[model samples]
Target: MIGRRACWGLGGLVMAMAGCGPAPAPQAADKPRAEAAAQATGAPGTAGAAGPSSTGGASSAAGGVKADEATKPAPPPESAFTPVAQIPEDLEIRLHPVEGALLVSTPNLTVVEGEQTNVATAVGVLKDGKIDFPERLRVPGWMVTVSGVHGRYPDQLDLIATGTTGRTGVAEHYALGAKGWDQRVGDAGQWFTGVARMGSSLVGLTGPTMIGRSRFVTLRGPRVGLTITPAPRKGECRGFDAEAASRYSEAEVRPEAFGATRDGTALSYGRNCNGDNAVEVWKPGEKRSTILPVPAPSEEQTTDEVRTLILPGPGDGEAWIVDRGVLRYQGGEAKKIDPPAKGARVLTASAAPDGTLWALTDDALFTRKGDAWEQAPLPDGVKARDVAVGSDGAVWVAAGGAILKHGGASEAAGAAPGTIQLQKGPPPKPRENRTLPRPGGPKCPQNLVVLYTFSKTAPDDYDFPLTRKALKGRTEFSPARFVVTRDMGQRFLAAFVPTWDLAKKLEERIKTDVRGSTPQIVCATPEVVRELKLDLKTGEVAK
Candidate 1:
């Protein structure tokens, strides 16, 4: 049963950019000098003041608002949403219908059997007929293969993604708050094959630790750790050795080992020592396991001959498995559920709360109403990749890049001034304008500079006053510094920036402030930093 109580805790805006604070007051002795410098340099205060008299109290005396008033950046433009006719149909897509919305994901590239690596670029949600992308959530260096949203509505949810970095599988959780999403990440120390949501917690299944031994361990939490245990293999095949097979490898089936039920149970599929297939039901917070045998059409059939797909059913403890024929499992029994069509292949299936079974095939959409199955209308010459059922019983289909609603209008949501609007359109760009810088900062791959001390014998003298006086009151340059120990001995440097243009400005500023001193600006972007072996903080070559 779906829990009536809402999941996911709401909090204050987590992603809001901090507003610039008021500039410190100039010293009484230097007050007049400071005003003179501001006037002479035409340096605007927090406000846009353009004249010599704009500094000091001249602006206020002339009846203008205080200079510090405008320093706060415009509240980052609220999530700008635009209506679209269809999601872009360029890549393969998957659809997940939750309580109040439909989520669309463009899966990452697959390099191995059941193993996916690399980041998933886009994630969008369809709520009230409008789609708004929360965009991609990331961990600095982890390659995220799979990600999903766990929540009851489109507006509120937790985004979770898992992937491997080096030998460890990492999970990143992005929780939505008033402003945007906040991130929490964890490391599994082992490869994760797949992820599932159980109640409020996210669970991940780990790949085998040893070459031939099958261990069914799970990685739980952005805070939870891994628990390793051998999978139950009973019947005659209980002692089957995974390493003995030269022609067929158990690695191929590893990805299919674990699945989730609607009621938050983790389902494991395996064969006993004798080769008879069975499913072990492990619910959240439970220690005992229930094994249900899967009745194969013929005893001679091997696991490879029949493909299996486990799907969440409408009620708690219910699941639908596609093995030759569609079989529904509830309580502790498995029974066949007839296909919507005589021989049409079911690519994906979703069960609605009303017991309505929604299935997507190669060329059509079908819904099982009572005992009769009927084809759902779709656009002409359309090919859909997946299907899902919302809590309200709305059937959504992912065909091409467009979302199609059964027995509903083909256009996007209606347009209102501040409400989400929709249009029959192509996929929207990542942000409003592709060329503009993001709200908080400029994008990466920019030229940066560090105020370096070239004096090998007495570098400390140059480093102290240079950083204390020349770099003070400079809000544009970064505070972090880099240090490198080369043939020239050791040197200290400061200021890492994003753009070559910005670096040049910093260079000029430093030259004017500290007479006769040369500041060296270097290109130390993430990629360049890696190639040069420059320690990001110390600037020394990484050993």
Candidate 2:
């Protein structure tokens, strides 16, 4: 059941960009100086002080805020925000709140839309947020929205926009491959959305009317395209939508074995159908007349039906096909490997960085090294649904809304898990525009927050010498900075401050408590916060 609960705990903090005018153009005389600064700081094309400043002071400022703020009683437990739901058994849910749409799918590729409560139509879901589909294509699976209108793949591919009446064009297509002919032609005026590439050949299927027959087309090159004549199937075998097809495109179906040579030609393994669950060998530049025999599963396995396939490395006729709980190596025959007993249902399979095949089950994770299968220890009481390996070779597991990262030694590896903390707090309220004068030292722009670094030599000295332009009045000049200290060796110390209203508050408290020594303030942008470097002391923004 869907539920809602208010978010609790220390909400993640974020920094935002302030409004600023366009930067001045650079002069010929300033070129050398700008280049030298870029070389020294390793920042290119950032001249005239128009771009964001460094984040060296961010960590110290955050630490300072924690040190000075009075301890407040913890708020009552929140019950209004529901945690993000985990993937259900046999069902994958994709939610796009910004577009007010949800997509639920089964392993067999059956998809249905959830009732949208919001007025917006959800287009696609993102790591940070969700985007809505344009009014042109109301069908969800037809087009995958990445970011903006231009954020589509292969610009040449024509997509359905809005019709003359501003309504979405509702059309369906079916892709069929027989012999010699491959065509995408359907009823003259209707639109269809099924197109995929098998090797170098493109296959498209379309069904114009719900009760009408479907047409199949194949395109080899720019000018060479074939329209297949359906051999007259008896019943309604052609009217199904793109979602009904067990396979769509190479982009959607994950490849198991690739670049393998069969009969002196390159071959790859791909899932055939949702019901058949067989992997077919695909060779480029081959005629559609060739048919490869489907391999059989081992005797211990009841289900020969493969769900997911993975090829560890470059090899001929070598691939790993996953059928239920067993991991089978496919060559001449399917050899099943005993999976970890603690594993529930296998969720996903992938080749680890070390060439070991790994699988994520409902209850545990299993890894195969050479011929031995080992079960990796999971966090106590945590159930996982999805897993992915990062470019850094670290494994990431997603359960419910929590994300855990595994790093370090083999035993220690996958042991320590870090949860993904999303930034929270009510969005900043809108404010009126106002102009203010520059202050002494490095003056931050109006609406810009600044981070200050305090010197350790004068640890007790926290007073800041403000220029008259910035001290006009509290109403006209209210700049905030957050401050914290860092240990540079045992004898030396550094402070980091960010450019924001919150940082200004820290500066005010320091000046009020400690007098004399002036603190240095620097600007920090939101990009620094994502780097995970903004802690209490070091001020390094997370990358």
Candidate 3:
């Protein structure tokens, strides 16, 4: 069952763009020594004999209302809000939906607008068709709203917020779980673009488009670290003769290992690029690896390297290598693990974060708890290639080249395991200004508009668009930044924002037409932009 409770926990406290306080108070020009005293109190006319003085008194002598007083926000109207948050007087908060954060930029003069990372949310209810908290929760910048469908769930949400800071000696944090959400997206300023999640790590993107060099939140442990670059690019698979000739060879899979699979994070190029010896394997952003020594080849073991599969362990920096038996590597040492079943040879093994070992044999799966290995259930006729366990201890298997996920958390969940199909290549770009009579799709010029969708499953109208203004520059393109959800669903787009201010009008115009509220000014997050793959020199997406 989906969690019904509101999971609002502070993901992290981020401090970016340090020392960027207000512009140093704007220095004044030097004055002549004779007139210095008069210039100090006069408005350039030099108050000699009550020149241009106010009716009540000299303007500088008795001040009633100051200039900045006009900018002070009026008291919030009465509402049903619970907490009376002390909104910052001089801070611009930006919620990066893909990164799942609310940021405070160097004091600016615009309203806060932005996005969040997690699809999990549970905003109570919406009174009318819209959420009223926008006015209730005071933020000086854009307030972003992310809603739409993720996989099979309708993760609808509506939230109104602005961020505060530690300098103010106050902090607020929230977390949304996999449960309910109020209908409608948040206020009209910032719009949610995309989201990525791995365990508790969440990333949100909000800008010209969800594709390309867009900004996103990157969570780290309890606090949010910084945004990161997209997947690291690897040299083509045809080189590496020099690096392989000397020492340890990388793990490699056969040609048939990744048949028709176009998406892969490169591990290491093979020696001589021949792929005959060491090959790169697939693992998440983990640091664990195994290099076990094997005895002379038997009839069953044709080549020693071919049978060696380095597997990641469940704990931090743990790993194992299996060649008919397991060699556990932990604490900077590799040791042999006693076989669980009688005379049973371990074929492949996987580690869980909790340090549990689940190994595959000829017939059954042996799980090691403490010192004992016990048999665990395996679906019949499923030829397993690799086994995996999530941070939450859910078991998964790579079988027949598909990811099978088993579940027992809820009774409504599947009895057996289920397969998750990954999108192989880049998803096709969404077409815009078509004759579809869409709210935001009121027939736009083909040359002026470009639309990008999160994935193939994205709704017909749920597409993000950019115009010539957004992409203005002597530019080309590159492969987008790929961010995956917990279900392996990918959201990507290509962005080359020459000047965020230049694209402001266009971003707001579309937000008004499609969003049905006020338009929003969307600035791409600078910190998260580096995590994307950019063709900076060429300014074109790689073919």
Candidate 4:
């Protein structure tokens, strides 16, 4: 915690002893100096440090220690943040735990008027002691937050995320398919509270658009459109503010809690919006939801009702809600279970598939041991806010921007024995095509048009051969100059065809058939290519 605070302001001196005195006020004149100091620290996006005199000479050395030593930010506890993954020190990181993988979301931040605003979310996946952050997932202009991630039956994984365009929230589905990954954006008008991927169907719980009930909607894919289910008035309550409701959506029943297990998905609604609380449990493959008579938590039980977390229990029709304490719900009855943290605050908790409970508190992770709570062995000085137990019995912790794994197998996690494993391998070598010459810069036949260009990098480099084999009859391929607005100094495989219409048709086919290829249609003539300062062979930017 001291390490996290040290990076905030005042050369780490004031924040170290923040309680010792009144905070130093920022002055107009010191802004430039502070900015320079921030840049000097290699963390230009961090908040500026206070002026020297603002510390009242308090930053000076004490007990023969140097002033510089007192102000240096303390080394962060051993985790992935530092020398491990090389993530920037200043980005805000949030963790969402999946079955075998951990999703790390770091929002791109830029300082505007000394305040930071999120421009985009950088997505990274941690598995098998390594992090794989594909370049394409780092989308700009759209701010996306992942709400849930689920591993499908075979090699596929699906991400349930909400992308906001500053004006409206859009539900996004990222499905790992034969083409590596593809996204389907559903303009559901608002973000989903959470989603459950049951077998072949995806159902999401969101706020009620009208007063008196929360609504359930279907998400993404061709067969499933945005279909809203009307809510029952059983546990209707007035929870949302009248003014705020009109500001976002006219939904009446806001989702208060949601959770899912192998057996089913459960959700509870009735937040201050003029209704009593109701819990709905829907089993997989079932068209109807079973309404449970669950009451809302008393004010004394929870500080913020919106922050209440619901966890699916091991047994069918059972679920757990984490409010002030853990509450076990089954058979229309609620039972209070003693948390492993005792009276300490539980930051997050997870239930393993075998009914074991794991809870993370401020100090350490607690697991039930007989009748007593046992603390799991963690790296010394480590602090984490979230915990999840993998199916293989490995403990995963999300601290800051990095992921920490414990007790898992050394090999990368794999799909079940009967299921298809994730695709892995080196890039395939380009096929032998002797008759046609390799792509020459801007030397295309007058009738030839650029269909698509693929980067000569791993994963994508593998696509060249696959695309060649798949579309051998329709187009010709060559090493073409790949240009951005300017030369990117990278090698690329440019696909060419005789007509623009054929190129367009080929572009769509490649995106669908080729694995991991997202190509754009570009009709680059020699003059247009030269104007863009294009070159691909040497990977050196054209002067």
Best by lDDT: 1
Report lDDT (Cα) of residue 126, candidate 4: 59
Model 1 CA deviation exceeding 4 Å by range: 1-84, 107-120, 127-143, 152-156, 160-162, 166-266, 272-275, 282-286, 296-309, 312-317, 323-325, 369-372, 407-543
Order of the predicted models by lDDT, top scorer first: 1, 4, 2, 3
Which is better, 3 or 4, measured by lDDT? 4
Q: Which digits, one per residue and each the tens of the lDDT, describe model 3 over residues 1-543?
A: 000000011100111111111110001112223243244334454423223323324433565334333233332222111111112222221111111111111123333346633221112111221112322222222212112112211232223221213211011122333432222222111212223333444333221111112222332233223232222234112111223332222122211011000121112211211212222232344333222232211123211111223444544545444545655545545466776666666544544546677776654556774656776643323343334454445554433222334432321122122222222222222111001000111111110111222445765333233322233342332222311111112222323234333233344433334332222221122122113333435433233
Of models 2 and 4, which has the larger lDDT? 4
What would the TM-scores of all predictions be?
Answer: 0.45, 0.32, 0.24, 0.48
Give me the overall lDDT of model 3: 0.28
The lDDT of each candidate is 0.42, 0.29, 0.28, 0.41
Off by over 4 Å in 4: 1-88, 96-101, 109-119, 127-130, 139-141, 152-155, 176-182, 197-202, 208-253, 269-276, 283-286, 295-307, 368-373, 400-402, 409-543
lDDT of 1: 0.42
Best-performing candidate as measured by TM-score: 4
Per-residue lDDT over 229-345 for candidate 2, one digit per residue giving the tens place of the 0 to 100 score: 332243112222233533112211112222222222222232221212233333335433122334432222211111233333223344455434543434544455666553344
How would you encode candidate 1's per-residue C-alpha lDDT over 292-320 as one tens digit per residue? 67664222221211223455766767776
Where is model 2 more than 4 Å wrong at Cα?
A: 1-116, 119-279, 283-317, 326-333, 342-345, 352-355, 390-394, 406-543
